[model samples]
Target: MKISEIVTILDGVLVAGKDQMDREISFGFASDLMSDVLTLETNDLVLLTGLCNIQSIRTAEMSDIPCIIFVRRKKVTPEMIELAEESEITLIECNYSMFKTVVTLAEHGIRPLF
Candidate 1:
């Protein structure tokens, strides 16, 4: 699915990288642990987490993740947004819990990065 579609589905706010809305996402991985995030070796995946911080952006950069969804209504700070923008990673903030976010994405055909 496209990042644009994900945003619409989650009723999320685009925190940064609005230009990347057309990017395709085929999988998703949800975690608050940056260490776990670093273990991913997949592409076309979106990171879903409630850990709203600069480290999330850094982890996404290291893992080559193109998009991040901040769950549980967590907000991304200006610093996090700047870092994400620098990495050209799209950041989304949504009110859904991590579980709901993952389920919704899955129901919409986004496979899990298991």
Candidate 2:
């Protein structure tokens, strides 16, 4: 699915990387742990996380995650957005809990990493 469609489905707001809204994402990896996020080796994956911080952005950069959906209504700070922008990672903010976000995306044909 496209990032734009995911934003609509999750009732999320695009906080950054508006140009990437058309990016295609096929896998959903939900995690609040940056360490766990670093273990992924896949393409076209979106990181669903509630840990809204610079670490999250750094981890995504290292893991090559193109998009990040902040769950549980967590807010992304300006610093986080700056780093995400530097890494060219799309940032999305949503109110859904992690589980609900995962279920919703899965229903929309986003495959799980496992």
Point to the candidate with the largest lDDT.
1
Which residue pairs collide, candidate 1?
A: none
Model 1 segments beyond 4 Å from truth?
Answer: none
Q: What's the distance in Å from true for residue 10, model 1? A: 0.4
Where does the lowest 10-residue lDDT sum fall in candidate 1? 36-45
Please write out the lDDT profile of model 1 over residues 15-96, one tens digit for every residue. Answer: 8999999999999999999999898789679999999988889999988999999999898899998888888999999999
TM-score of candidate 2 versus the correct structure, residues matched by position: 0.97
The alpha-carbon root-mean-square deviation between model 1 and the true structure, to one decimal in Å, is 0.6
TM-score, every prediction: 0.98, 0.97
**Candidate 2's residue-wise lDDT over 1-114, tens digit each?**
999999999999999888888989999998888988888889579999989889999999998899999999999999999888888899999999999999999999999879
Clashes of each: 0, 0
Query: Best-fitting candidate, measured by TM-score?
Result: 1
Candidate 2 has an lDDT of 0.92
lDDT of each: 0.93, 0.92
